[model samples]
Target chain A: MGSPAPERIVRFSGTVRLAHWLLASTFFVMLFTGMCLYLPALSRLVGRPTAKAWHLWSAIALLVGIAVLLLIGNRRSLTGVVRDADRLDQDDVAWLKGGPRRLFDHDDAPPQGRLNAGQKLNTMVMLGLMVVLAISGTLLWLGERDTTYRFGGSVLTHDLASLAIGFLVMGHLYLALVHPTTRHALRGMVVGDVDRAWAERNHATWAMSESVQSAERNA
Target chain B: MTANAPTPRPGGRPIGRAAFLGTVATGVGSIALLSRYSGSVQAAIQKVSAAVPGVNQIAPTAGWRIYTVADQMPTFNAATFKLKVSGHVANPVTLSWSEVDALATETQVTDFHCVTGWSVDKVHWEGFRARTLIDLVRPAGNARYVTFVSTEAPYVDQLTLAQFTAPGVMVAKKQDGVALKQEHGAPLRLVVPAMYGYKSVKWVGEIRFDAKRADGYWEQNGYDVDAFIGRSNGLTGS
Candidate 1:
């Protein structure tokens, strides 16, 4: 037999992988349907009424889907993501301060826990943008019923939030799918594990501490 | 011969004038016959177009949704109506109903659109082309923007001179071969095929050529000034 398989580290649990895929799929659905509603040419292709129905229904599905997934998924691990992203330790501050240099060389980044400083910012900002979009989108839909909603700047706010979300999502895709060093990051979200060596090099503290293995097994 | 009744050239030779006149008479007779039964033709046209999706939304009685700032359409009278042409024009003359009708009649068959993603296609419109009005009241060299005031006190809109005078832009007096109904902007209304219906001010009472741009009622309330059909409304930003 070949040498024993290289030890694997659980970078993400099954629940986290499912959540990642769920969010990623919904992001595309919203992007494509939102575009249909935004561009007049596309609106004519399927008819405006049809496009509006699809966009509205898809948004509802996404909001409901996330709520249901969180309720059914591993409570500790799922909640841990929020907890980790919320609190910024000294290493996270240093990592954030590292700025542009960290993008070029991962080694310049501090030995962060499971969640990094950049990821924390991305998570917080994305959540804030979603809240803005939900409110503005609801107002825009109500504009047909009353002109008051039209005067509320809901259209401008919805469009601006969508643009910001799209920009951040593109950056996220670049790291997962295109970046040379972080290309393996996709595997953690896909298979719920990463090579022990890759984990040691990128997330030395999380891999060496075996903190994820002990805490996440219970999850 | 009437242009519509011209005979096809045979052996590369022009037809005789008498023969042409005879052909024209026949064409005239055919037109009379068609008009005698035009009711059926109109019914057929309506039947086919109404079957098409997004086409049945312009009926005055049912389809079209009327919006008025004062909760009513401004009353119009052909006899007393006057459209004042003032501001940056060399000739600031007022036109009566007869004077307005005296200008050459131009017609168009194009789609009319509302800002709310609704449209009425192939609407037959008859009016005096904007160019005719431009020639009658020559705007000053410095005049750039055009403003229109509706008979309704609060309903007003503005457009650039180029947009106001573009092809298919007209001071419409008739729609679908019928005098405009009161609800649809009777005596005269502006018809702008290039922009949404809001820019096409109804019950037009005043036309002004000004040097500076002024916001319309909707624009003052946060709507886009240049409301082009697809590219405007702040939906897309460069």
Candidate 2:
């Protein structure tokens, strides 16, 4: 019997993968330093000033990296992800109703686009949270330098955003690394590709569309 | 499920529902334990502060930020330092540092909130209560406000009669069980726990009971005159 065809497909572009990893690292640094700043006991491990410096610098780096990637990297792919996330149809609604169990049982899930319902939801939530964090963090930094630039709500916003994002990140990590079925999804972020069979099963609608476009281009 | 479906490798090791639940449980348990430990540490710090004389709070010095309006901190001669209590009072007195220190001392543990969004909690302030000084030079019925003048800088702030005589408001002489440093308004500084740090003027050289409201340095520069804690300066609901 002949061996099956190679089950591999380009799932993410190089720029997307780079941005993903960069953001992941930056997020971890921010999380650690931010925790240090929030919890007084943890502040003893790394002095408050050092933790503050790390948190501020990492936040700046994250913002710069995001801006650079959007400006110079795969703007098309970024826009596509955003557009796809925004376009949640009946299938996404059905998937949401079926809940996390359907996520584990891929065959039970409704056919999805390039991004799944959960991923779309995550993207939107993270986007909103990032905007809040950025604005609040900037206000806090400004207040630190110039006492006159302070706003009372800035602290509340920054603190709430940090905690919410931290919890969201935990859930994100659990699904990407610990969940029985979705753990393989991390590969798409790391190596920029996923097994074609896995993609066909998980994202059948997107895979079928890609195949039709490829054939049309070839013809 | 497809007949030809490939086995999913979860980072090379399969994690079952029990394992996932276990991980989450452990995480939550660790957090709870850490918080409990933190509470114990806080209690211990408070205990230590209470044991030490002239200390009523236990905020770490590292948490405080030195803020100056003109980017300048002035030095003072402790030997020549005098606290002048005048204006709308029955007896106007000019007392030296020794005389001020000789007054009935009070200790209070309170949170020092800054308008700039940072707070130093559980600060041990040991000094003469504002009521003591107010009583020493009983204010005239017309005296509705009290003005604090900083000796080193051109900074000034005022408080209403009620606010000036409120409980826990004092002129602190020592902080964290030691003499107040110059950077922290050495020899004498006002500690208004119920108001923002800006209203707690450092290097207090004079206290004047006034007939009308007087704007301090910060108030003239757009800050609220009544810098009440969690009330003025947009700190409400925060």
Candidate 3:
């Protein structure tokens, strides 16, 4: 009989998975409600008042969820992502220059850590955008409550940031769902683990490092 | 009156003095009822106008909520209302509604953009150009800014001398083909089409040309002094 298949690698912790889903759900709700408010054609379907309420509540929830995750749920994962995103070594630069084609071609692509170059760039952009959106959205809400609270060009900033985030979300979804090579990536986020073979093939450097650390611990 | 007018046969109808008297009474009674009804209708309309002032003049396309700091609108007699233009000018002048209206008038259909993410497009405004007032006052070379003071509220707004003199800026008196209502600044309100709505002060009573920049009501509260559309306040893209 063939040897038993290798155990799956734990790609995401339980806290990380929980935080990801909460954020995803909140973001989707906000996006839907925001689109209803922004598009005149869709406004009638959802109604402006209802859509506005949902959008505001969802935004608040997203912020709260992020705070909870950072402060209580999984500080280690959050810090790791943030720290790794900031440091782009030569390999990451090479990966970025090689582009997605190189990733798909699988022609000796650069070894990556927990996050690849694309994900690092995405994380940085998303972090900046989230900060902007939070500030702008709060200002907008205050302005709505009282007209006296007029912040200059805040409306434009809110609109532009929201649009950028919307596009980013779409791109992220496509990569995780539609891309042939990355379609199975969603399982890792959902189940918190990835098949050993897949992890070895896609994240060879990370897999090797994890194995070495496990060996050291065992020894 | 004919004393011997034809007498009515059985069921033929009454004639002469009694009939004439009846007809006269009916006519007077109908006239009284009509006048009373018209008076009540007028009163009802006035009550509605008092409750929701300027509801009729608001354009359907004006999609923004009205915002006022003061709970009550400032009361002013249009006939006695005076707009004083003073400070840093060759000639300081005080003009009444008639005098202001007597100057050249222009009508514009433009969008009124509030900094708070809402905009009203195609607002029809009829008023005298700010240039006409500026020409009359003739700001001195030392003047760098223009400050607008509200007549009833503790609100003030400032604009650069260049912005005040720019085209499309005016002291608007009418909106949507009717006289501007009390809630909408009544006699005169400043209109700066290119800038945010706060720069356009409502119920403007004074225009002061200043040598130095002065903070407006919002500007004093952490808002940018120069509220140019999409350009001011470090809101440009990354």
Best-matching candidate per TM-score: 2
Pairwise TM-score winner, candidates 1 and 3: 3
TM-score of each: 0.51, 0.59, 0.52
Residue-wise C-alpha lDDT for candidate 2, range B14-84, written one tens digit per residue: 11222334443443443334323433443554566567854432132224655554334556676887889
Computed on C-alphas against the true complex, the DockQ of each candidate is: 0.01, 0.06, 0.02
lDDT of 2 by residue, A1-219 (tens): 699866766667776677778878988998887766665445346655577778878878888987898899876665555556665667777888899677456678888766777787777667666666776677677765554566654654565567667778999999899987777788888876677778788887777766666566579
**For candidate 3, lDDT tens digit of each residue in B1-238?**
0101111111211222232344334333423342234334334444564567564232212254444555455666868889899999999999987887788889999878666545666799999876887789898999989889998568899888888878888889898899877667777888998887878898889999999987788776566677776655434422
Flag regions of model 1 displaced more than 4 Å. A1-3, A211-219, B1-238
Of candidates 3 and 1, the better by DockQ: 3
Question: Please, what is the whole-model Cα lDDT of each candidate in the order they appear?
Answer: 0.68, 0.71, 0.68
| Clashing pairs in model 2, backbone N/Cα/C closer than 3 A | B57-B124
**Cand. 2 Cα-lDDT:** 0.71
Cα lDDT, model 1, residue B126:
95
Residue pairs with backbone overlap in model 3: none
